[model samples]
Target: MEKIAPVRLSVLGHPQRLAVFRLLMRRFPDRIPATELAQALNVKPNTLSNYVSALMQVGLLTQERIGTSLRYGIDMQSARETFDYLLLDCCRGRPELCAPTSNFDLNNKASKKYNVLFLCTGNSARSIFAEAILRQEAGDRFNAYSAGTTPRAGLNPFALEVLQQKGHDISVLRAKNVSEFQAESAPQFDFVFTVCNQAANEDCPAWAGQPVSAHWGMPDPVKAEGTDAQKSLAFQQTYGALRNRIRVFASLPLGSLDRISLQSTLDDIGQLENGVSA
Candidate 1:
Protein backbone atom coordinates (compact mmCIF):
# COMPACT_ATOMS: atom_id res chain seq x y z
CA MET A 1 0.00 0.00 0.00
CA GLU A 2 2.87 2.36 0.83
CA LYS A 3 4.44 1.66 -2.56
CA ILE A 4 1.13 2.21 -4.35
CA ALA A 5 0.48 5.63 -2.73
CA PRO A 6 3.49 7.19 -4.45
CA VAL A 7 2.40 5.76 -7.79
CA ARG A 8 -1.06 7.31 -7.34
CA LEU A 9 0.49 10.63 -6.30
CA SER A 10 2.89 10.60 -9.27
CA VAL A 11 0.07 9.95 -11.76
CA LEU A 12 -1.75 13.07 -10.51
CA GLY A 13 1.45 15.14 -10.39
CA HIS A 14 1.13 16.31 -14.00
CA PRO A 15 -0.93 19.49 -14.50
CA GLN A 16 -3.33 18.05 -17.10
CA ARG A 17 -3.83 14.79 -15.23
CA LEU A 18 -4.61 16.71 -12.04
CA ALA A 19 -7.12 18.84 -13.92
CA VAL A 20 -8.82 15.71 -15.26
CA PHE A 21 -9.02 14.23 -11.77
CA ARG A 22 -10.47 17.42 -10.24
CA LEU A 23 -13.08 17.77 -13.01
CA LEU A 24 -14.19 14.17 -12.51
CA MET A 25 -14.38 14.76 -8.76
CA ARG A 26 -16.64 17.78 -9.26
CA ARG A 27 -18.90 15.77 -11.59
CA PHE A 28 -18.91 12.69 -9.38
CA PRO A 29 -21.80 10.17 -9.59
CA ASP A 30 -22.38 11.39 -13.17
CA ARG A 31 -20.01 9.75 -15.60
CA ILE A 32 -19.02 12.14 -18.39
CA PRO A 33 -18.59 10.92 -21.96
CA ALA A 34 -15.12 11.12 -23.47
CA THR A 35 -16.13 13.72 -26.05
CA GLU A 36 -17.61 16.01 -23.42
CA LEU A 37 -14.57 15.61 -21.20
CA ALA A 38 -12.23 16.45 -24.06
CA GLN A 39 -14.16 19.56 -25.03
CA ALA A 40 -14.38 20.73 -21.42
CA LEU A 41 -10.66 20.32 -20.81
CA ASN A 42 -9.75 21.76 -24.25
CA VAL A 43 -7.45 18.81 -24.84
CA LYS A 44 -7.16 16.65 -27.94
CA PRO A 45 -9.00 13.30 -27.76
CA ASN A 46 -5.76 11.36 -28.25
CA THR A 47 -4.00 13.28 -25.50
CA LEU A 48 -6.94 13.02 -23.06
CA SER A 49 -7.14 9.28 -23.65
CA ASN A 50 -3.60 8.87 -22.32
CA TYR A 51 -4.36 10.92 -19.19
CA VAL A 52 -7.61 9.00 -18.62
CA SER A 53 -5.81 5.73 -19.01
CA ALA A 54 -3.21 6.64 -16.37
CA LEU A 55 -5.87 7.62 -13.79
CA MET A 56 -7.82 4.43 -14.46
CA GLN A 57 -4.65 2.37 -14.09
CA VAL A 58 -4.11 3.88 -10.64
CA GLY A 59 -7.72 3.01 -9.61
CA LEU A 60 -8.65 6.69 -9.28
CA LEU A 61 -11.23 6.51 -12.09
CA THR A 62 -13.78 4.05 -13.43
CA GLN A 63 -15.10 3.81 -16.97
CA GLU A 64 -18.09 2.10 -18.53
CA ARG A 65 -19.64 1.82 -21.99
CA ILE A 66 -22.72 4.03 -22.23
CA GLY A 67 -23.96 2.82 -25.59
CA THR A 68 -21.07 3.19 -28.08
CA SER A 69 -19.15 5.85 -26.22
CA LEU A 70 -17.07 5.40 -23.03
CA ARG A 71 -18.05 7.43 -19.95
CA TYR A 72 -15.67 8.11 -17.03
CA GLY A 73 -16.18 8.94 -13.35
CA ILE A 74 -14.09 8.99 -10.21
CA ASP A 75 -13.89 5.88 -8.05
CA MET A 76 -14.73 7.48 -4.70
CA GLN A 77 -13.52 4.57 -2.58
CA SER A 78 -10.14 4.54 -4.28
CA ALA A 79 -9.80 8.31 -4.08
CA ARG A 80 -10.62 8.20 -0.39
CA GLU A 81 -7.99 5.53 0.16
CA THR A 82 -5.40 7.65 -1.64
CA PHE A 83 -6.20 10.67 0.50
CA ASP A 84 -6.25 8.62 3.70
CA TYR A 85 -2.88 7.05 2.91
CA LEU A 86 -1.35 10.46 2.26
CA LEU A 87 -2.59 12.00 5.48
CA LEU A 88 -2.58 9.01 7.84
CA ASP A 89 0.61 7.29 6.71
CA CYS A 90 2.82 9.50 4.53
CA CYS A 91 2.34 12.54 6.75
CA ARG A 92 3.47 10.50 9.78
CA GLY A 93 -0.09 10.51 11.18
CA ARG A 94 -0.08 14.26 11.78
CA PRO A 95 -3.11 15.24 9.74
CA GLU A 96 -3.25 18.73 11.23
CA LEU A 97 -0.08 19.69 9.36
CA CYS A 98 -1.79 18.93 6.06
CA ALA A 99 -4.91 21.05 6.59
CA PRO A 100 -5.85 23.46 3.80
CA THR A 101 -4.71 27.02 4.42
CA SER A 102 -8.09 28.60 3.64
CA ASN A 103 -10.93 28.35 6.13
CA PHE A 104 -14.33 27.12 4.87
CA ASP A 105 -16.43 27.65 7.98
CA LEU A 106 -19.36 29.57 6.53
CA ASN A 107 -22.01 29.65 9.24
CA ASN A 108 -25.59 30.17 8.13
CA LYS A 109 -26.13 32.80 10.80
CA ALA A 110 -22.70 34.36 10.39
CA SER A 111 -22.08 37.79 8.92
CA LYS A 112 -20.42 36.14 5.92
CA LYS A 113 -23.07 36.22 3.23
CA TYR A 114 -22.91 34.61 -0.20
CA ASN A 115 -24.14 36.23 -3.40
CA VAL A 116 -26.15 33.84 -5.59
CA LEU A 117 -27.63 34.50 -9.02
CA PHE A 118 -30.36 32.48 -10.70
CA LEU A 119 -30.70 32.75 -14.47
CA CYS A 120 -33.28 31.91 -17.15
CA THR A 121 -33.79 33.00 -20.76
CA GLY A 122 -36.45 35.64 -20.08
CA ASN A 123 -35.88 36.63 -16.41
CA SER A 124 -39.68 36.72 -16.22
CA ALA A 125 -40.62 33.46 -14.52
CA ARG A 126 -38.35 30.65 -13.31
CA SER A 127 -35.37 32.79 -12.36
CA ILE A 128 -37.63 35.26 -10.64
CA PHE A 129 -39.27 32.47 -8.71
CA ALA A 130 -35.86 31.20 -7.59
CA GLU A 131 -34.65 34.64 -6.49
CA ALA A 132 -37.76 35.32 -4.44
CA ILE A 133 -37.86 31.82 -2.95
CA LEU A 134 -34.21 31.83 -1.98
CA ARG A 135 -34.60 35.26 -0.50
CA GLN A 136 -37.58 34.14 1.55
CA GLU A 137 -35.79 30.94 2.56
CA ALA A 138 -32.34 32.34 3.48
CA GLY A 139 -32.17 36.06 2.84
CA ASP A 140 -29.93 36.71 5.82
CA ARG A 141 -27.37 34.12 4.75
CA PHE A 142 -27.54 34.58 0.98
CA ASN A 143 -28.11 37.55 -1.30
CA ALA A 144 -30.21 36.10 -4.13
CA TYR A 145 -30.33 37.77 -7.55
CA SER A 146 -32.00 36.79 -10.83
CA ALA A 147 -31.38 37.78 -14.45
CA GLY A 148 -31.82 36.59 -18.04
CA THR A 149 -29.95 36.29 -21.34
CA THR A 150 -32.50 38.11 -23.50
CA PRO A 151 -34.77 39.62 -20.87
CA ARG A 152 -38.40 40.52 -21.43
CA ALA A 153 -39.67 44.05 -20.88
CA GLY A 154 -41.52 43.04 -17.73
CA LEU A 155 -42.20 40.21 -15.33
CA ASN A 156 -44.61 37.39 -16.19
CA PRO A 157 -48.03 38.20 -14.74
CA PHE A 158 -48.77 34.60 -13.78
CA ALA A 159 -45.36 34.28 -12.17
CA LEU A 160 -46.00 37.39 -10.14
CA GLU A 161 -49.45 36.15 -9.21
CA VAL A 162 -48.20 32.81 -7.93
CA LEU A 163 -45.43 34.41 -5.90
CA GLN A 164 -47.80 36.92 -4.38
CA GLN A 165 -50.29 34.16 -3.58
CA LYS A 166 -47.53 32.41 -1.67
CA GLY A 167 -46.97 35.60 0.44
CA HIS A 168 -43.71 36.67 -1.20
CA ASP A 169 -43.13 40.38 -1.80
CA ILE A 170 -43.26 41.15 -5.55
CA SER A 171 -42.99 44.92 -5.52
CA VAL A 172 -39.18 44.97 -5.99
CA LEU A 173 -39.07 42.22 -8.63
CA ARG A 174 -38.04 43.43 -12.10
CA ALA A 175 -36.60 41.85 -15.22
CA LYS A 176 -32.93 42.60 -15.79
CA ASN A 177 -30.36 41.56 -18.40
CA VAL A 178 -27.54 39.21 -17.37
CA SER A 179 -25.10 41.87 -18.54
CA GLU A 180 -26.16 44.09 -15.66
CA PHE A 181 -24.74 41.60 -13.21
CA GLN A 182 -21.61 41.11 -15.32
CA ALA A 183 -20.47 44.71 -14.91
CA GLU A 184 -17.31 45.48 -12.92
CA SER A 185 -19.27 47.31 -10.23
CA ALA A 186 -21.71 44.41 -9.84
CA PRO A 187 -21.45 42.32 -6.71
CA GLN A 188 -19.07 39.37 -6.95
CA PHE A 189 -21.31 36.32 -6.98
CA ASP A 190 -20.38 33.18 -5.05
CA PHE A 191 -22.77 30.93 -6.98
CA VAL A 192 -24.79 31.10 -10.23
CA PHE A 193 -27.54 28.75 -11.38
CA THR A 194 -29.37 28.38 -14.71
CA VAL A 195 -33.02 27.50 -14.13
CA CYS A 196 -33.97 26.96 -17.78
CA ASN A 197 -32.51 24.84 -20.57
CA GLN A 198 -32.06 27.72 -23.02
CA ALA A 199 -30.11 29.88 -20.56
CA ALA A 200 -27.99 26.88 -19.56
CA ASN A 201 -26.86 26.37 -23.17
CA GLU A 202 -26.47 30.01 -24.10
CA ASP A 203 -23.06 31.64 -24.34
CA CYS A 204 -23.20 33.73 -21.17
CA PRO A 205 -20.87 36.62 -20.48
CA ALA A 206 -17.83 35.95 -18.32
CA TRP A 207 -18.84 36.76 -14.78
CA ALA A 208 -16.62 38.45 -12.25
CA GLY A 209 -15.07 36.13 -9.61
CA GLN A 210 -15.98 33.08 -11.79
CA PRO A 211 -18.81 31.80 -9.58
CA VAL A 212 -19.64 28.11 -9.20
CA SER A 213 -22.39 27.30 -11.73
CA ALA A 214 -24.97 24.55 -12.30
CA HIS A 215 -28.04 23.92 -14.47
CA TRP A 216 -31.33 23.43 -12.65
CA GLY A 217 -33.44 23.29 -15.83
CA MET A 218 -37.18 23.11 -15.48
CA PRO A 219 -40.15 23.68 -17.84
CA ASP A 220 -41.01 27.28 -18.73
CA PRO A 221 -44.23 28.07 -16.94
CA VAL A 222 -44.83 30.99 -19.28
CA LYS A 223 -45.05 28.57 -22.20
CA ALA A 224 -47.67 26.37 -20.61
CA GLU A 225 -50.62 25.56 -22.87
CA GLY A 226 -54.32 25.67 -21.97
CA THR A 227 -56.53 28.09 -20.02
CA ASP A 228 -55.39 30.77 -17.59
CA ALA A 229 -56.20 28.45 -14.69
CA GLN A 230 -53.97 25.72 -16.14
CA LYS A 231 -51.26 28.27 -16.86
CA SER A 232 -51.38 29.53 -13.28
CA LEU A 233 -51.18 25.92 -12.12
CA ALA A 234 -48.01 25.51 -14.18
CA PHE A 235 -46.46 28.52 -12.49
CA GLN A 236 -47.48 27.10 -9.12
CA GLN A 237 -45.78 23.79 -9.88
CA THR A 238 -42.65 25.61 -11.01
CA TYR A 239 -42.66 27.50 -7.75
CA GLY A 240 -42.88 24.28 -5.74
CA ALA A 241 -39.99 22.77 -7.74
CA LEU A 242 -37.74 25.78 -7.21
CA ARG A 243 -38.64 25.92 -3.53
CA ASN A 244 -37.93 22.22 -3.08
CA ARG A 245 -34.47 22.59 -4.60
CA ILE A 246 -33.77 25.82 -2.72
CA ARG A 247 -34.71 24.30 0.63
CA VAL A 248 -32.10 21.62 0.20
CA PHE A 249 -29.56 24.18 -0.99
CA ALA A 250 -30.17 26.42 2.00
CA SER A 251 -29.75 23.48 4.34
CA LEU A 252 -26.35 22.50 3.02
CA PRO A 253 -23.44 22.58 5.52
CA LEU A 254 -21.16 24.75 3.43
CA GLY A 255 -18.48 24.75 6.12
CA SER A 256 -17.99 21.01 5.75
CA LEU A 257 -17.53 20.76 1.97
CA ASP A 258 -14.58 21.70 -0.18
CA ARG A 259 -15.18 23.34 -3.54
CA ILE A 260 -15.26 20.06 -5.50
CA SER A 261 -17.68 18.39 -3.07
CA LEU A 262 -19.89 21.51 -3.00
CA GLN A 263 -20.05 21.54 -6.79
CA SER A 264 -20.93 17.85 -6.90
CA THR A 265 -23.69 18.43 -4.35
CA LEU A 266 -25.05 21.34 -6.40
CA ASP A 267 -25.14 19.13 -9.51
CA ASP A 268 -26.97 16.41 -7.61
CA ILE A 269 -29.45 18.98 -6.32
CA GLY A 270 -30.24 19.88 -9.93
CA GLN A 271 -31.25 16.27 -10.54
CA LEU A 272 -33.85 16.30 -7.76
CA GLU A 273 -37.37 15.46 -8.97
CA ASN A 274 -39.73 18.42 -9.41
CA GLY A 275 -41.99 17.70 -6.44
CA VAL A 276 -39.31 15.99 -4.33
CA SER A 277 -36.87 17.45 -1.85
CA ALA A 278 -33.48 15.87 -1.13
Candidate 2:
Protein backbone atom coordinates (compact mmCIF):
# COMPACT_ATOMS: atom_id res chain seq x y z
CA MET A 1 0.00 0.00 0.00
CA GLU A 2 1.20 3.50 -0.83
CA LYS A 3 1.46 6.18 1.87
CA ILE A 4 -0.68 9.32 1.61
CA ALA A 5 0.92 12.50 0.32
CA PRO A 6 1.93 14.95 3.08
CA VAL A 7 -0.55 17.66 4.12
CA ARG A 8 2.04 20.32 4.92
CA LEU A 9 2.22 21.15 1.21
CA SER A 10 0.23 24.36 1.25
CA VAL A 11 2.24 27.60 1.39
CA LEU A 12 -0.98 29.61 1.64
CA GLY A 13 -0.35 29.80 5.40
CA HIS A 14 1.87 32.74 4.42
CA PRO A 15 0.76 34.62 1.33
CA GLN A 16 4.19 36.18 1.26
CA ARG A 17 5.78 32.78 1.16
CA LEU A 18 3.45 31.76 -1.63
CA ALA A 19 4.41 34.92 -3.48
CA VAL A 20 8.06 34.07 -2.89
CA PHE A 21 7.49 30.61 -4.28
CA ARG A 22 5.86 31.86 -7.49
CA LEU A 23 8.69 34.35 -7.92
CA LEU A 24 11.37 31.72 -7.44
CA MET A 25 9.78 29.11 -9.66
CA ARG A 26 9.50 31.76 -12.37
CA ARG A 27 13.06 33.04 -12.18
CA PHE A 28 15.59 30.93 -10.42
CA PRO A 29 16.68 27.18 -10.27
CA ASP A 30 17.77 29.05 -13.38
CA ARG A 31 19.04 32.45 -9.79
CA ILE A 32 17.21 35.63 -9.21
CA PRO A 33 18.28 37.71 -6.21
CA ALA A 34 16.28 39.07 -3.25
CA THR A 35 15.58 42.39 -4.96
CA GLU A 36 14.26 40.59 -8.01
CA LEU A 37 11.86 38.57 -5.92
CA ALA A 38 10.71 41.76 -4.15
CA GLN A 39 10.40 43.63 -7.40
CA ALA A 40 8.34 40.81 -8.82
CA LEU A 41 6.17 40.90 -5.71
CA ASN A 42 6.06 44.72 -5.95
CA VAL A 43 6.90 44.99 -2.25
CA LYS A 44 9.34 47.33 -0.58
CA PRO A 45 12.89 46.05 -0.05
CA ASN A 46 12.63 46.17 3.74
CA THR A 47 9.21 44.48 3.76
CA LEU A 48 10.50 41.79 1.42
CA SER A 49 13.48 41.20 3.69
CA ASN A 50 11.16 40.14 6.51
CA TYR A 51 9.07 37.94 4.21
CA VAL A 52 12.17 36.35 2.79
CA SER A 53 13.38 35.56 6.30
CA ALA A 54 10.18 33.70 7.08
CA LEU A 55 10.16 31.83 3.74
CA MET A 56 13.77 30.77 4.02
CA GLN A 57 12.95 29.35 7.42
CA VAL A 58 10.65 26.90 5.69
CA GLY A 59 12.02 24.29 3.25
CA LEU A 60 10.03 25.99 0.49
CA LEU A 61 12.65 28.64 -0.19
CA THR A 62 16.36 28.33 -0.92
CA GLN A 63 18.77 31.24 -0.74
CA GLU A 64 22.33 31.79 -1.88
CA ARG A 65 24.46 34.80 -1.01
CA ILE A 66 25.84 36.60 -4.03
CA GLY A 67 28.56 39.24 -3.80
CA THR A 68 26.09 41.89 -2.62
CA SER A 69 22.65 40.23 -2.56
CA LEU A 70 20.73 37.05 -1.74
CA ARG A 71 18.89 35.10 -4.43
CA TYR A 72 15.96 32.83 -3.69
CA GLY A 73 13.67 30.51 -5.63
CA ILE A 74 10.77 28.22 -4.83
CA ASP A 75 12.37 24.92 -3.99
CA MET A 76 11.22 22.70 -6.90
CA GLN A 77 11.28 19.46 -4.88
CA SER A 78 8.88 21.17 -2.46
CA ALA A 79 6.73 22.28 -5.37
CA ARG A 80 6.60 18.68 -6.65
CA GLU A 81 5.66 17.67 -3.08
CA THR A 82 2.78 20.15 -3.10
CA PHE A 83 1.57 18.70 -6.40
CA ASP A 84 1.62 15.22 -4.85
CA TYR A 85 -0.46 16.57 -1.94
CA LEU A 86 -3.01 18.07 -4.31
CA LEU A 87 -3.28 14.66 -5.93
CA LEU A 88 -3.87 12.92 -2.56
CA ASP A 89 -7.00 14.93 -1.86
CA CYS A 90 -8.33 13.78 -5.21
CA CYS A 91 -7.79 10.18 -3.99
CA ARG A 92 -9.69 10.40 -0.69
CA GLY A 93 -12.02 7.34 -0.24
CA ARG A 94 -10.95 6.37 -3.75
CA PRO A 95 -7.32 5.47 -4.20
CA GLU A 96 -7.95 5.72 -7.92
CA LEU A 97 -7.87 9.49 -7.44
CA CYS A 98 -4.10 9.35 -7.04
CA ALA A 99 -2.85 6.65 -9.34
CA PRO A 100 -0.40 4.22 -7.75
CA THR A 101 2.12 1.95 -9.47
CA SER A 102 1.00 -1.47 -10.76
CA ASN A 103 2.41 -4.67 -9.28
CA PHE A 104 2.73 -6.81 -12.42
CA ASP A 105 5.85 -8.91 -12.81
CA LEU A 106 7.90 -9.06 -16.05
CA ASN A 107 11.31 -9.87 -14.65
CA ASN A 108 12.67 -12.02 -17.49
CA LYS A 109 10.67 -11.25 -20.63
CA ALA A 110 10.94 -7.87 -22.35
CA SER A 111 7.75 -5.97 -21.56
CA LYS A 112 5.91 -3.90 -24.14
CA LYS A 113 6.10 -0.15 -23.83
CA TYR A 114 3.00 2.05 -24.05
CA ASN A 115 1.70 3.38 -27.39
CA VAL A 116 0.87 7.11 -27.76
CA LEU A 117 -0.85 8.80 -30.66
CA PHE A 118 -1.04 12.55 -31.30
CA LEU A 119 -3.79 13.93 -33.50
CA CYS A 120 -4.27 17.18 -35.38
CA THR A 121 -6.54 18.62 -38.05
CA GLY A 122 -3.96 19.03 -40.80
CA ASN A 123 -0.92 17.03 -39.71
CA SER A 124 1.24 19.74 -41.30
CA ALA A 125 2.28 21.63 -38.18
CA ARG A 126 1.22 20.72 -34.64
CA SER A 127 0.97 16.97 -35.17
CA ILE A 128 4.41 16.89 -36.68
CA PHE A 129 5.79 18.84 -33.75
CA ALA A 130 4.18 16.60 -31.10
CA GLU A 131 5.22 13.40 -32.88
CA ALA A 132 8.88 14.37 -33.12
CA ILE A 133 9.21 15.60 -29.56
CA LEU A 134 7.39 12.62 -28.04
CA ARG A 135 9.51 10.23 -30.07
CA GLN A 136 12.71 11.95 -29.01
CA GLU A 137 11.76 12.23 -25.33
CA ALA A 138 9.68 9.10 -24.74
CA GLY A 139 10.39 6.74 -27.64
CA ASP A 140 12.36 4.31 -25.48
CA ARG A 141 9.50 4.21 -22.98
CA PHE A 142 6.51 4.71 -25.31
CA ASN A 143 5.91 4.27 -28.99
CA ALA A 144 4.67 7.66 -30.22
CA TYR A 145 2.73 8.36 -33.44
CA SER A 146 0.90 11.35 -34.96
CA ALA A 147 -1.80 11.54 -37.62
CA GLY A 148 -4.16 14.16 -39.06
CA THR A 149 -7.92 13.86 -38.95
CA THR A 150 -7.83 15.24 -42.48
CA PRO A 151 -4.48 14.38 -43.95
CA ARG A 152 -2.02 16.78 -45.54
CA ALA A 153 -0.07 14.66 -48.02
CA GLY A 154 3.37 15.81 -46.93
CA LEU A 155 5.42 16.95 -43.93
CA ASN A 156 5.42 20.62 -42.97
CA PRO A 157 8.72 21.91 -44.38
CA PHE A 158 9.13 24.35 -41.53
CA ALA A 159 8.26 21.68 -38.98
CA LEU A 160 11.14 19.65 -40.31
CA GLU A 161 13.44 22.68 -40.27
CA VAL A 162 12.70 23.81 -36.71
CA LEU A 163 13.00 20.26 -35.34
CA GLN A 164 16.43 19.87 -36.90
CA GLN A 165 17.42 23.31 -35.62
CA LYS A 166 16.48 22.13 -32.15
CA GLY A 167 18.68 19.02 -32.53
CA HIS A 168 16.00 16.48 -33.55
CA ASP A 169 16.60 14.38 -36.68
CA ILE A 170 13.67 14.30 -39.12
CA SER A 171 15.21 12.85 -42.24
CA VAL A 172 12.77 9.95 -42.31
CA LEU A 173 9.55 11.75 -41.30
CA ARG A 174 6.35 11.91 -43.37
CA ALA A 175 2.71 12.96 -42.92
CA LYS A 176 -0.41 10.72 -43.03
CA ASN A 177 -4.07 10.83 -42.02
CA VAL A 178 -5.79 9.32 -38.95
CA SER A 179 -7.64 6.86 -41.20
CA GLU A 180 -4.41 5.13 -42.06
CA PHE A 181 -4.08 3.96 -38.45
CA GLN A 182 -7.79 3.19 -37.96
CA ALA A 183 -7.90 0.05 -40.08
CA GLU A 184 -9.13 -3.28 -38.67
CA SER A 185 -5.65 -4.36 -37.56
CA ALA A 186 -4.44 -1.15 -35.95
CA PRO A 187 -1.96 -1.23 -33.11
CA GLN A 188 -3.59 -0.76 -29.72
CA PHE A 189 -2.96 2.68 -28.30
CA ASP A 190 -2.14 3.12 -24.63
CA PHE A 191 -2.71 6.86 -24.84
CA VAL A 192 -3.70 9.52 -27.37
CA PHE A 193 -3.32 13.32 -27.32
CA THR A 194 -4.90 15.77 -29.70
CA VAL A 195 -2.83 18.91 -30.30
CA CYS A 196 -5.07 20.83 -32.65
CA ASN A 197 -7.66 22.97 -30.88
CA GLN A 198 -10.34 22.15 -33.44
CA ALA A 199 -9.83 18.37 -33.43
CA ALA A 200 -9.51 18.39 -29.67
CA ASN A 201 -12.91 20.09 -29.46
CA GLU A 202 -14.54 17.82 -32.02
CA ASP A 203 -16.00 14.43 -31.19
CA CYS A 204 -13.24 12.04 -32.07
CA PRO A 205 -14.01 8.48 -33.08
CA ALA A 206 -14.51 6.23 -30.07
CA TRP A 207 -11.11 4.63 -29.99
CA ALA A 208 -12.27 1.00 -29.80
CA GLY A 209 -9.09 0.08 -27.97
CA GLN A 210 -10.23 2.48 -25.22
CA PRO A 211 -6.78 3.60 -24.16
CA VAL A 212 -6.39 6.80 -22.14
CA SER A 213 -7.23 9.81 -24.28
CA ALA A 214 -6.72 13.49 -23.48
CA HIS A 215 -6.22 16.88 -25.09
CA TRP A 216 -3.22 19.14 -24.79
CA GLY A 217 -4.70 22.07 -26.60
CA MET A 218 -2.43 24.40 -28.54
CA PRO A 219 -3.02 27.07 -31.17
CA ASP A 220 -2.02 26.31 -34.75
CA PRO A 221 1.39 27.73 -35.41
CA VAL A 222 1.06 27.25 -39.14
CA LYS A 223 -1.58 30.00 -38.98
CA ALA A 224 1.13 32.57 -38.40
CA GLU A 225 1.56 34.59 -41.60
CA GLY A 226 4.72 36.66 -41.74
CA THR A 227 8.48 36.46 -42.08
CA ASP A 228 10.32 33.13 -41.80
CA ALA A 229 11.68 34.08 -38.37
CA GLN A 230 8.19 34.72 -37.01
CA LYS A 231 6.91 31.39 -38.35
CA SER A 232 9.99 29.65 -36.96
CA LEU A 233 9.33 31.17 -33.54
CA ALA A 234 5.80 29.83 -33.64
CA PHE A 235 7.08 26.33 -34.39
CA GLN A 236 9.64 26.66 -31.61
CA GLN A 237 6.95 27.47 -29.04
CA THR A 238 4.87 24.54 -30.29
CA TYR A 239 7.87 22.23 -30.05
CA GLY A 240 8.74 23.33 -26.52
CA ALA A 241 5.21 22.84 -25.28
CA LEU A 242 4.96 19.30 -26.63
CA ARG A 243 8.42 18.47 -25.32
CA ASN A 244 7.48 19.53 -21.78
CA ARG A 245 4.33 17.40 -21.66
CA ILE A 246 6.08 14.38 -23.17
CA ARG A 247 8.71 14.64 -20.46
CA VAL A 248 6.01 14.53 -17.77
CA PHE A 249 4.24 11.51 -19.30
CA ALA A 250 7.50 9.67 -19.80
CA SER A 251 8.44 10.34 -16.18
CA LEU A 252 5.39 8.41 -14.94
CA PRO A 253 6.16 4.94 -13.61
CA LEU A 254 4.26 2.93 -16.23
CA GLY A 255 6.04 -0.30 -15.30
CA SER A 256 4.38 -0.30 -11.89
CA LEU A 257 1.57 2.24 -12.30
CA ASP A 258 -1.89 0.87 -11.45
CA ARG A 259 -4.69 1.36 -14.01
CA ILE A 260 -6.90 3.38 -11.65
CA SER A 261 -4.04 5.63 -10.64
CA LEU A 262 -2.85 5.86 -14.22
CA GLN A 263 -6.30 6.79 -15.49
CA SER A 264 -6.67 9.50 -12.84
CA THR A 265 -3.27 11.01 -13.61
CA LEU A 266 -4.12 10.84 -17.30
CA ASP A 267 -7.32 12.72 -16.55
CA ASP A 268 -5.29 15.34 -14.72
CA ILE A 269 -3.16 15.58 -17.82
CA GLY A 270 -6.31 16.78 -19.57
CA GLN A 271 -6.29 19.85 -17.35
CA LEU A 272 -2.98 20.69 -18.93
CA GLU A 273 -2.93 23.37 -21.60
CA ASN A 274 0.00 23.56 -23.96
CA GLY A 275 2.68 22.01 -21.68
CA VAL A 276 2.97 23.74 -18.31
CA SER A 277 -0.71 24.13 -17.46
CA ALA A 278 -0.81 21.01 -15.24
lDDT string for model 1 (184-243, tens) is: 799878789988765764555656555778778788999999999999999999999999
TM-score of 1: 0.64
Per-candidate TM vs. native? 0.64, 0.57
Point to the candidate with the largest lDDT.
Answer: 1
**Candidate 2 residue pairs that clash:** 99-261, 101-256, 101-257, 101-258, 102-256, 102-257, 102-258
What residue pairs are clashing in model 1?
none
- Cα RMSD (Å) per model? 6.1, 12.0
- Among the numbered candidates, top TM-score falls to 1
What's the true lDDT of residue 158 in model 1?
97
